[model samples]
Target: MEFANEPIFQWMSQFAYQPGMVYAGLIAMMALSAVGFPLPEEVTLISVGILAFMGAHPAHFPPPYEGAPVVNVHTAAIIAFTAVVASDTLIYVIGRVFGRKLLYHPRVHKFFPEHMMKRVEEWTHKYGAYACGIFRFTPGLRFPGHLACGMLRYPVWKFLVIDGIAALISVPTQIYLLAHYGEPILKYLRQFKLVLFGIIGLLVIYFVAKKIHQRWAARAASR
Candidate 1:
């Protein structure tokens, strides 16, 4: 835990001030996580959060298509959405390439519980690669999801297309919210006021609900 928060990690914080560097980092970081490194994506995202506050965009351009001197958060998110999609897609392919070897490694195998891996395989087999979107938000399960798609032989073109659509939904919205309350977020955190708890709480609820659904389905399958 301490290692993850050390000067090394803080140094990664420098990506916040550099737009090209940050996007590159985001791609590389997500790819690394998607490739099974287990560096916390949330922590990488928080750097972007601080950068967003600093008026730095982690994305390439973000969108609106309006002609003017410039666009705002929405535009920036739109522009960067494509990059986000590409990053995850490449990671998915990398996962497919190394899925079996990674699965055999004791550490990587731990990321996927034996039974859960079976469930992911079954689900992806039935539902196809679109499951990536559903599983992408899942922190621990993400790599497994990619592997499952690969194992199930989900079509690559379809997977990439669906991943892009999902990125469109996920990346921009996250960036926008980070920008919206950038200063207040920093101020509150400094003061320990923490109103962002509401947003984080909602995401937790979403995760818990998904977990519950997965568990219930698993139990039913056993029955």
Candidate 2:
């Protein structure tokens, strides 16, 4: 596919021959993303998926890589699932240890602003421990939402069970599907890139507008 030539894909291709390094990099990226790294966790997951695809179809790759050991899709998926849960559990531990006091730390407060924290509190109250599932689904809210789950003292077991289920549904599925069906998927993506991007743009605008309206309502309520 044309995307194989893209810079990010090209970079990932280098790891096609080193399964160990690929797994290590995946764990590192997931850990960093869990702890407020600027990059999205999906990017790393997608890269891993692509790399797994390359490994299975080594003939598509050039030179030495064609005969080298590479990432296995199933193993990659397992590592991804474990890494994500571990990273998320770490965030929960931090919140539980620090309690609400953690929220007010200068470094932390900036990430979980007053408005955002208020929403997190509302979700916790509304959904109880089940809100952990919501947090797992929403990328922008994951870090702060998971933190609030711990701060509010939801049972650690419940958080793990719920988050683990969500992670299972999301993490491994991406890798398996991409590795098995990369060519068709890439072809479709290239064909409908504009349509897909436009839909994404609209979703972003809708969420931004919703947030602004919520903030305005909050301000009015205070008055």
Candidate 3:
């Protein structure tokens, strides 16, 4: 995939000239995501990875940005890792401070639907602090899941250890791999973008059908 032709890359490239701004933006995105921002942190991470790749291969970018300072891949990875852990910890703190009350708050409740909240609770009940890893891996569940961990009053050290390990395994590795092998990966993504979209669409339909089936079963049981 030509970096210049990709609109996401084009938009992010504008910040390559000011690496500090890029880092700040990434931290802000991660923090917002922790508080249930509609955008996923993965999008920001992937964008950072692509930006790092472009920085390493400035010639691949168009003019103006071509001469800009590079966004160091390692530095970006460290910043991303730190930002993710810190933001997630903030969610944990909110849960700790407000306890269950935060969950019932009108604004907060809207972000976490009942079914999803049930799933988070189930995972926590089953796995204990280890469930923090599950929440870290699961995109939609992260915010509420982390909050639940805090609400349960799991040890701060345990939460940090578990979440940090998960972040270490996922966050920096993604940026590093993309920085090193982004061209081929992007090429494969471009080629299979339609296939990926189809798979995602099918998954959505399956989940919706399952939810309807579950509700119907509950209604029948009540009758």
- Tell me the number of clashing residue pairs for each predicted model: 7, 0, 0
* Cα deviation of 129, candidate 3, in Å: 0.6
Q: How far off is residue 213 in model 3, in Å?
A: 19
List TM-score per model, in order.
0.59, 0.80, 0.79
| Model 1 vs truth, CA RMSD | 10.5
Candidate 3 per-residue lDDT over residues 1-223, each given as its tens digit: 4636766557666665568888989889988877766566777787788778877766666537335676788999999999999989999999999999888675566545678889999999999999988899897789899999999999999999999999999899988888788898777766786797687688668756654675566556547
Alpha carbon deviation, residue 87, candidate 3 (Å): 0.7
TM-score of 1: 0.59
Candidate 1: where are CA atoms >4 Å away?
1-17, 56-83, 94-111, 193-223
Which pairs of residues have clashing backbones in candidate 2?
none
Q: Candidate 1 clash total? A: 7
Candidate 1 local lDDT, 1-223, one digit each (tens): 2222334334533444456656666656766655545454665555565555444332332222323122244444654565556656665676677767765465555444577777777767676767888766666666678766665556788887776677666666667767666655555554542456566677668756755665566566557
Residue 64 Cα positional deviation in candidate 1, in Å, after optimal superposition: 30
Better of 1 and 2 by lDDT: 2
What are the per-residue Cα lDDT tens digits for candidate 2 across 1-77?
A: 66666554566577877899989999999898786665668878877887888777655654363367888998999
Task: Looking at model 3, report the run of 10 residues with the lowest lDDT sum.
Answer: 58-67
Q: If candidate 2 were superposed on the true structure by all CA atoms, what would the RMSD be?
A: 5.0
For candidate 3, the lDDT comes to: 0.81
Give the winner by lDDT: 3
Model 3's TM-score against the true structure: 0.79
